[model samples]
Structure formats: structure tokens, C-alpha cells
Target: MHPSTLMMGYGYEPRLSEGALKPPIFLTSTYAFESAADGKRFFEGITGKRPGGSEGLVYGRFNGPNQEILEDRLAQWERAEEALSFSSGMSAIGTALMAHVQPGDVIVHSAPLYAATEKMIDAVFGKFGVKWVDFPAHASPAEIEETIERAKGLGRVSVIYLESPANPTNDLVDIEAVSALRDRMFADAEHRPVIMCDNTFLGPCFQAPTQNGADMSVYSLTKYVGGHSDLVAGAVVGTRDALAPILALRNTLGTITDPNTAWMLLRSLETVQLRMEKAESNARAVATFLKDHPKVERVSWLGFLDPSSSQGEIFKRHCSGAGSTFSVIVKGGEPEAFRLLDNLKTVKLAVSLGGTESLASHPAAMTHLSVPEARRAELGIGDNLVRVSIGVEHEDDLVADFEQALKAV
Candidate 1:
């Protein structure tokens, strides 16, 4: 069944909720067990005293009605076996990484990552003796394998983390190739590293990372899934067994999404398909307008990509679309780029993406600032690059605003 069709009512029965159409917020922090025997069984599953049959909710930290239902819907969107929500995208990423690695373990990651994520590697993960190695998002499978091999030499490669259709740059990463190599290299190993992809840039509608080869697809639900720019949440969806450890970690760390946020996500998922598709359509229109402008040096939207190259093939094999968030390099460098952004009257100057209204920001000055002064340009995110998050705005109005804004440049 189509996900949108099922989003309204799947995993929820109104009959159990006083016949209400929508699921309630489940505001309580704990669930009441029928008897001591039932409570013992629930705790047994929670404490890992026994195996499986852990669906029974014991506490808010472990499970909640709204959280569980939202997870079910998100898992359906990614075609994953299970899903878990978190307080924020960083928390989700941190949990996913920490679940797989201990001291002396290594993480092989993709470059041009969201700046805070890069910071997290050194600030949080690094302090614990975990190491990280990075490869370009556009690297070939062989090159990536070389990076992983190098990571293994430092310590056991416990996680292969990636942010594909990379932030600000919008470059595609080869998920299928990475998954194939992981299988080939670790087939006989008892503990194989997971290929975890951040699907926030494209979300589930534009790209299915898990289907392409990733073991887990993570998202900052603050962006696309929430749709209205009102909530802050994150998610990870993968095989139940693969996510069990992350779930346990989330429980232990108390990073689970609050019931109110979970309920908001439930409301947002109902229209996510409609909202994202509209935004993508607007982005293509805006990208087309910017590409022809003399002041715009380059419009890095994937809409103009050639489908025959290796990167194109990788995109074609994985992503369903180019997505709405992309970068534009303006003429006259930083001064002109900042001028254009400052003069914008319609599009808001902001950092976050996937909202109902368009936004424009300088990645070098804002989102990717943590990438270090020298490496920012090396990563293809220069001072003149403006990252635009297209929204469900009227195409003609958006183009007109950008056109007038460019006159400042």
C-alpha cells in the first residue's frame, strides 16, 4: 500500500483510543501493567534478561504510543524493518555511532558533512578515544574502500557514516557500492560495520538509502518530515536487529523524542509527500532561473546533471530526484554573494532547510563554518556559495524576488 494512503491510520486503531480518528499525544511517562507477572515479563525484555517479545511498553524512556506509531510510519517510508526517533539530529547520529564503536574503534565518514556533525566527531566521539577517517562524498568505491582499509589499520572500522547528496554542495555518494564492499569485506566477520547514511538532504521521498545499500537511513526530522518548521526531531530507520543497539542506547541516554514532538511528526507525515513534492517542483523552477542569470556563476542544482556519468549513474540508481536544497555560487565572490543574500526580500535568510517558505544562506559563513577556514574551500563550499532551500512558494514570485535580489550583486 502507498505510504501516504496508510499514514493516516496505520499502526493505530481508533477503537483502542475511545474511537478518536487521530492518535492521542500519550502524555503519560509510564505504562501500567495488568499484573506483577506481566510487569516481570516486560522488565525481562527491557533488561535483556530474555530475547524478543519486547513490544510491551514499560516506561517513557523505552517506549510510548505516539513514538511507536510515528516510528512505524517512518519505517514504512524508508522500507526499513524498524525505526527510532530522537530529540535532535545530532543526538540520533551520536547514538548511531556510539552504539557500534567503543574506545579505539574507528568511523569511516564522508566529507562535506553538516558542520555540527563534523564537530561531533572530534568534540564528542574523539574524546572517548574513537577515531574518524573521511572520504569525499563523490569518491569512487575503490577510493572509499582504501579509506576504510586505512581506518581499519587504525582500529576496527565499526561504522561507515555518510551524508549523501551532501549538504550545501549537493554531491551524490555511492551507497550501493559501499554496501557491496561492506558485504564482500566483512561477510565472514561476526561484527560487520554498518553503512549508515544521512538522508536529510533528500529525505525518503527523493532517495531511499536503505534500498540502495545502506543499513540505516538517518534524518533530522526538524527539516522535511516536520514540514512546517515548528518541530525539532530526528530519526533512524533500519533492520530491527541492526537498530536494537541504537534503541537500547537511546533508551539509556534518554534521547528519545518527546510524545508531543512524536505527535507533531505524526501530523506532519500525513502531508509530507504532498509538501516535499511541491517544494521540489519549486526548487527546479528556481534553479532554472538562477542558472541563466549572468550574476550567478553556477547553480549546483542536480536538475541539470548528466545521467550518463558515474556520479549520474550513482544518482540514477539511488535517488528518485535531485531534491530541493542546493547551492549557488554567485559572481564577485563573497561580497556579491552576501549582497544577493542580504537584498533578498521574499526568501528568508536562514540556516535550516525544508520549510513552507524559501530560505537562502551563505554556507561558508553559516552552516559549513565549522569546516575550518582552509578546508571549507577545499571541500567545494567557498565563500560565494549560497545554499537555498526551496519551499512550496509560487514559482513566478520566487523567481521575481531572486531576480531583483541579484541586481544587488
Candidate 2:
């Protein structure tokens, strides 16, 4: 069944909820067990003393019916074996990193990470003696392999982190190529590194990382999955074996989303496909209009990518759409870019994307500001770049709004 159809009621039963036709938010911190033995059995299963088949609820932070249902339904989006939800995107990311990393391990990753994440790796992880090495997201597989080889001098490589259509730039990474390189490089190692892909920019609708050989697919549910900008959440999906440590760490850290937020996520899932379809169409039209404008220097929308190029081929294999977010470099520098942003009446000047309303952000000065000046320029995050996220608005209206805004330049 399609994700849209399954989202309605895949992991829930109406009769279990007093025939209400939808699961209620079980707003309780603790649950009643039938007997002492039942409580023991559940804990044993959770702690891995018993392999499987643990039934009944325990604690809200540990496990709840709403969160379970949300995880089950989300797994179907990427066809993953298991899924876990968290209070926020960074919580999910931090917990996943801790589960697989240790004091002496290294993280070899693609550059242009979300600003906060890069800062966390530099500040927090550095205190524990864990090191990180990075290369551009567009680096060839062989080039990335050389970087990994260089990282071995520092510590054992435990994680290969990536964010495709990376943050504000929308650069595509070859997930399959990286996975193959990891296999070739570390076949006889003590423990091979895990490929963790952040699917926030184009997930659930267009890209499936695990299907392309990544060990885990991570997401900021605040973006595409939540769709309405009403809630904040995150998730990770992978095979049950790959996720065992992550689940254990999540329970220890109490990072699971609340029952109420889980219920809201359930509501949003129903219309994700529909919302994404409309927004993608609007983005294609918007990019086309901007491409021909004399004042627009470049539109980094993937829909305009040359199909014969390496990046385009990888995008074709991994993503089904260009998605609604892309960056535009204006003819003039920062002054003209700021004018366009200031003149927009309908679209918002905002930091976050994938909301119901359109938004524009300056990558160099706003979103990716934490990155150093030289590094930002190297990553193609120029001062004139304005990252635009198209919404489900009428294409004509969106184009007209952009046209009027560009006139200020």
C-alpha cells in the first residue's frame, strides 16, 4: 500500500481505543501492569534479557502506545525494519552518535552539515577526545576513501555521516558510492563504520537512504514529516540489529517524544504525500521562472541539473523529485539579495523550511553562519545566495511574488 493510505491506520486498531476510530493520547507517566511478573517480563524484554515478544506498556518515556504507533507507521515510509522517535532532531542525532561512538573513535563525514550539528561535533565531542574529519559532499567516492584513509592516523573510523541535498546548498551526495567504498575499505576491520544519512531535506517523499545501502536514515521531523510547522520532533529508521544500541541509549537518555506530540505527528502523516506533491510542482515552476530572469545569476534547484552529470545521475537513482527548497544567487551580492528578501510580501524571511508557507533565508549570513568565511565560499554558500522553500501556494502567485521582489534588485 502507498504511504498515504497506510498513514491512516497501519499500526492501530479502533477497537483497542474504545471504538473511537483513532488512538487517544495516553497522557500518563506510568502504566498499570496486570501482575508483578508482567512488569518483570516487559523490563526484561526492553533490557534485552529476553529476545522478543514483550507486551504491555511500562513508562511514558520508555514506551507508549502513541509513540509506538507513530514509529510503526513511519517505518513504512522508508520500508525500514524499525523506527524510533525523539523530542527533537538534535536529540535523535546526538543519541545516535553516542550509541555508535566512543572516546577514541573518529567520525569521517561530508561537509556543509547543519550549523548546530557541526558545532556540537567540534565542541562537545572534542572534550571526550573523539575527532572528526570532513570533505565536501560532492567529493567522488575515491576521494572520500582517501580522506577516510587519512583519518585512520587519528583514530578508528566508527561513523560516516552524510546529509544529502546538504542543508542550504542542495548538493547531492552519492550514498550508494560511499556505502560501497566503506565496504571495500574496512572489510576486515574490527568494526566497520556505519553510514548515517540525514534525510531531513528530502525524506519520506523523495529519498530513502537505507534502500541505497545506508545503515540508518535520520530525520528532523519538524520539516517535511510534520509538514504544518506546529510541532518539533525527530526520528531514526534502520534494521532492528542496527538500531539496538540506539534504542537502548534513547531509553537511557529519555529522549522520546511526548504522547501529545506523537499524536500530532500521526495527524500530519496523512497528508504528507499530497502536500509534497503540490510543493514540488510549485518549486519546479519557480525555478524555471528564476532561471530566465536577467537579475538572477543562478538557481541551484536540482530540477535544472544537467542529467548527464555525476550529481544528476546520483540524484536520479536516490531521489524522485527536486523537492521544494533551493538556493538562488542574485546578480548583485548581499545588498540585492537582502532587498529581495525584504520586499517579499507573501513569503516569509525565516530560518526553518518545509512549512505550509513559503520562506527565504540567507545561507551565508543566517543559516550557515557558523561556518568560517573561507569554508562557506568553498561550499558555494555565497553572500548573494537566498535559500527559498516553495509552499503549496498557487504557482502563478508564487512566481509573481518573486518577480515583484526581484524588481527591487
Candidate 3:
């Protein structure tokens, strides 16, 4: 079934819960077990002592109606066998990292990552003795292989994390190439590295990382999945084997979303396909408009990829759409970027993306601000680059808004 159609009643059976059309928020912390035998069985299954079977409710932490239903629906959309939800995107990311990484292991990540993700790797993971090596967005397939070889020389490579259509800059990475490299890296039984992709930018809609051989796919459900800016949540979807540990960690860490948030996500999922399609159309129109504007130095959008461009083929093969997020480099630096941001009336000057409303942000001083200046330069996320997230608004209105905003610069 189509995702939009599935969104209405996937994973949730109204007949299961007093014939409620919508799954009611299982708003309690504990559930009543039918008997001591039932409690023992539930705990046994949760702790892996016994296999889980189709049965009655378990402890809230172990599994709740909201969490289980959400996971079911999410798994269907991403085409994964299972899924787990977290309280926030970073929690989902960090938990997945923690599950696979250990002290003295190395993680090779793609460049132009979301700033917070960088902090988790550099600052947070550094304390635990996990090392990192970055592969730039424009790096060729050979360069990625070489980087892995170099990292292997230092020690073991445990994880390869990628954020394609990388935040701030709309550069695309070849997931198939990376997956092939991962197989080579793990050819020896001594070391096997997991390939994880942050698919938040163009997730279950435009791209499916697992389809291209990624071990797991992550998303900041706070963005496109939530649709509106009201909810903050995250999710990781993968095969049952890859996601079981993540679910266990999630339960122990207590980073699960509440029933209300899960309900909101369910509602949002219904409209995600429609919302993303319109947003992508709006973005294509806006990007075309920006390409012809004299003040815009360059537009980094996958939709604009030239046939000769190195990333063009990868984008064409993997991405269903160019996504709604793109960055434009103005003639001047921070001053010009801010001037354009400040002048926008319809598109708000904000940090988050993938919402119904358009938003513009400056990487140098906003999302990527925490990244060191030197490192930021190396990644090509410059001060002049202004990121815009097109919404379902009128394209002409958005174009006019950008035209007027460019005048301010």
C-alpha cells in the first residue's frame, strides 16, 4: 500500500482497543499483568530469556501501545523489518552509536554533518576514546576507501556514519559506494563495521538508506515526520537484528517518546507524502529562480546537478527527489546572508527545517556555528551559504520573498 494510504490505519487495529478508531494514548507507566505467570513470561521475553509471542500487554518501559504502534507504522514506511523511537534525534543517534561503538574504535563520518552530531562524535565520544575521521562531501569513492584503510591502520573501524544531502550544504553522498567499501573493510572476520545513514533530510519519502545497503537509517522525526514544529522526536529503523539492541538501550535509557507525541507523529505520517511532494516542487521552482538571479553566487541543490558533476549520477540513482532543503551562496559573507534572512517575510529566519512554513538559516552563525571555523571551511559550509527549507506555500510568493530579500544584501 502507498505510505499515504497506510498512514490512515497501518500498524494500528482499532478493534484491539475497545473499538477506538484511533489508538488511545496508553498514558500509564505500568500495565496490569493477568497473573504472576503472565508477568514472568513478559519479563522473560523482554530480557531475551524467552522468545516474544503474540500476547497481552507488557511493562510500559518494555513496550507500550504508543511505542509499538509507532514502530510498526515507521517500519512499514522505511521498508525495514523493525524500528525504535527515541525522545529526540540526538538521543536516537547517540543511542545507536553507543550500541555499536566501544572504547578505542574509530568512526568514519561524512562531512557537513549536523552540528550537534559533530559534538556527539568529537566532544562526547572523544571522552570515551572513540576516534573519528571525516570524509568530505565531494570526496570521491576512492578517497572514502583510502580514508577507511588509513583508519584501519590506526585500529579497528567499528562504524561508518553518513549524513547525505548533508545539513546546511545540499551535497549528496554515494550510499552504494560507501556500502561497497564497508563490505571490503569487513571482509576479514577480525573487524566488521556497521554503516549507518542519517536519513532525516530525505528519509522514508525521497530516500531509503537500507535499500542502498546501509545497516540502519536514522531520522529527526522533529522535522518532516512531525510536519508541524510542535513535536520533538527521533527514530531509527532497520532489520530486527540491527534494531533489537537499539530498542533495548532505548528502554533502559528511558528516551522513549510519550503517548501524545506518538499520536502526533501518527497524524503527521498521514500527510508526509503530500507535504514532502509539494515542498519538493516548491523547492525546485525556487532553486530554478535562484539559479538565474545575479546576486546568488551558487545554489547547492541536487536538482540542479549537471551531467558532468561527479555527484550527479549518485543523486539520480538514489534520490527520488532533490528534497526541500537547499543552500544559496550570496556574493558577500555573513553580513549578506543575514541581510537576506532578516528581510524575508514569508520565510522565517530560523534554524530548523522540513516544516510547513519556509525557514532560512545561516550555517556560520546558526546550525554549524558550533563547528570550529577551520573545520567548517574544510567541509565547504561557508559563512555566505544561506540554507532555505521550502514549504507548501505559493512558489511565486516564495520567489518574490527571496527577490526582495536579496535586495537587502
Candidate 4:
């Protein structure tokens, strides 16, 4: 069956809990075991002393009725062997990076990453002596190879990280090329690098990084997966080997999402396909309107990508859909961007994306400001760039809002 069809009840059984059609929220901190033997086995699994083999819940941090069901549904959607949830997007990313990265290791990352992620790698992880190296979003395959080589010179390049349809810029990164680069750079089995792709933008719906050889695919479930702005959550989906360490770190750090959030995610997962499809359609209309507006200088949207463009071919090959988020560079800088933003009546001027409601924010000052000014400029994100997360709003109404906002600008 199609994913949308499966989303309705893929991982849940109606009779599993009190014959209720929907899964109930298991709100307790821990679950009861059948006996002392069962408790010992569950504890052993939680602490990695033994394999529970999907028998029952252990601890709130390891597994729960709500979290287990949600992970099963999501893992199936992502075509992953296992999935893990976290408190927030950053937590998931941090746990994944920290699990594989260690002191004296290097991470080769793509440009225009989320400011929080950049700060985590540079400030937080750097204290532990982990090195950060940036690779151009538009770099040729050969150039990417060289970038990996340069990082290897500093130390062992343990991870190749990428944020495709990058935050703020809506740029594309070649997952297959990256996988190739990882293989070529770390052909030596002992020094191999794991490829991790931030699939938040395209997601388990529009794009699957693991299909292109990514070791792990991460998402800020707070966005499309949650589909509502009320919750904060993140997810990691990959093979058990690649995901086990991340899951272990999540347990130790207590970064797991609560039962309520997990239940909400399960609810949201059911409608993700419908919501994303509608949002993508709305985005196409919005991007086209922004492109023709005199006040808009440029638009970085997957919908408007040309086949002739360098990144265009990669976009065509990797992405089944041009996700719902895109950025517009106004003719003037921050002032004009703000003018348009302030004048909008339908869309809220806020951070975060991929919810049912439209949201807009300035990348330079909002999401990516923590990135150094020099690095921000080098990545081409200016004060003029305004990122818009297209929601389920009517395309005509959204276009009207943009029309009025552009007039004000």
C-alpha cells in the first residue's frame, strides 16, 4: 500500500490497548514488568547488557508504549530498520554527531547550516577538540573530494554532514556525490567516515537520504512530522548499528521526547503525506509569484530550479518533490524584507517551518545569526533573504498576502 494509506494505521493495532482504536498515551515514567525476571531482562536491554528483542518496554528513556509505536510507524515510513526520537531537532543532531565524533576527529559539513548546529559543532564540540570544516554547497564533485582531503590532513574525517535544501538558502546537496566522496576519502576500512544527512527539509516523504547511501537520516519532527506547532521533537532513522549509539546517548542525556509528544507525532504522521502534498502545491504558486514581483531580487526554491542549473540536475535526481519551504531575496536588504514581512496578514513572521500555518523569518538575524558574520556572507545568506514555510493555506490567499507585502516594500 502507499505510504499515505499505510500512515493511517501502519504500526498500531487497535486491540493492543483496551481495544481502543487509537493508541493511548503511556504517561508514566516507567512500565511494569510481568515478573522480576522480565524486569531484569528489560533493564538489561535498556543498559545494553542484553537484547530485549522487542518484548516489552524498559525505561521511559529507552522505550515506551507511545514511543515504540511511533518509532515503528516512522521507521516504516523512512524505510529504516530502526528509528529513535529526541526532545528536539538539535538534540537529535547533537546526539548523532556526538555519538560518532570524538576528540581529534573532524566533521566535513555543508554550508548554510542551522546556526544552532553550527554553534554546537564549533563552540560546544570544539571544546572537546573536534574540528569543523565547511564544504561549498555548489562545489563540484572533484571540489568536494578535495575538501574532504583538506579535512583529513587536519585529522581523521569521521563524519560527512550535510543539510540539503539547506536552512534559509533552500540549496541542494548531492547525497550520492557525498556518499561517493566518503567512500573515496575513507577507502581505508579503519578510517572510514559515516555519512549523515539532515533530511529535515525534504524529509521521510519527499527524499530518503539512506536510499542514496546516507548512514543516517535526521529530522526535526517539530516541523512536518509533528505538523502542529504545539510540540518539539526530533528523530533519527537508520540501521540498528548506525542508530544504536545515538539511541544510547539519548537514553543517558534524557533527551527523549515525552509520551504526549510521541502520541502527537503518531497523529501527525497520519496526515503528513496529505499536508506535505498540499503545501508543496501552495509553495509552487507562491514561488512563481515571488519570482515575477519587482521588489523580489531572487528566490531560492526547489520548485523554480532549472534543469540547466548545476544544482538543478542533482535536485531532479534526488528530490521527488520541491519541498514546501523556500527563500526570497528582496530587492533591498533587511528593511525591505521586514517591510514585506510586517505587512503580511495571513502568514505569521516567526521562526521554524513545515507546520500547517505559514511562517516567515529573516535568516541573517533569525535562524543563522549565530554563525559568524564572515561565514554568513561567504555562504550568500544576506539580510535580504526571507525564508517562507508554505503551509496548507490557500495559494491564492498566500499570493495576495505576498502581493500586498511586496507593494509595501
The segments of candidate 3 whose C-alpha lies over 4 angstroms from its true place after superposition are: 51-56
Q: Write the per-residue lDDT of candidate 2 for residues 1-409, one digit (tens) a residue.
A: 9878999999999997899778999999999999999999999987878886347788886889999999999999899999999999999999999999999789998888888788777778889898999988888888888898988888899999999988888888899999998998899999899999999989989999999989999999999889888899999998888788898888789999999999999999999989888999999999999999999999989888889898889888999988999999999889999999999988899988888889999988997888899988887788999999899988999999999999999
lDDT for 218 (candidate 4): 87
Task: Go through the candidates in order and give each one's C-alpha lDDT.
Answer: 0.89, 0.90, 0.87, 0.87
List model 1 lDDT by residue over 1-409, tens digit each.
9888889989999999999999988889899999999999988887777877364988999889999999999999877999999999989998988888888788889988999988988778888898999999999999998988888788788889999989878888999888988898878877799889999988878888999889899999999999888999999999888798898788789999999999999999999889889998999999999998888899988878889988788888888888889899988788999999999988999889998989999988888777788889779989889999999989999999999999888
Best by lDDT: 2
Instruction: List model 4 lDDT by residue over 39-85, tens digit each.
Output: 87766777778763436787777778888888887787668898888
Q: What's the lDDT for residue 138 in model 3?
A: 66
Every model's TM-score? 0.98, 0.98, 0.97, 0.97
Task: Mark the regions of model 4 whose C-alpha exceeds 4 Å error after superposition.
Answer: 51-54
- The reply for model 1, stretches above 4 Å from the true place, is none
In model 3, where is the ten-residue run with the lowest total lDDT? 51-60
Residues 18-61, candidate 3, lDDT per residue (tens digit)? 99998898788888887999888777767767764325567666
Off by over 4 Å in 2: none
Native-referenced Cα lDDT, model 1: 0.89
Give the clashing pairs for model 4: none
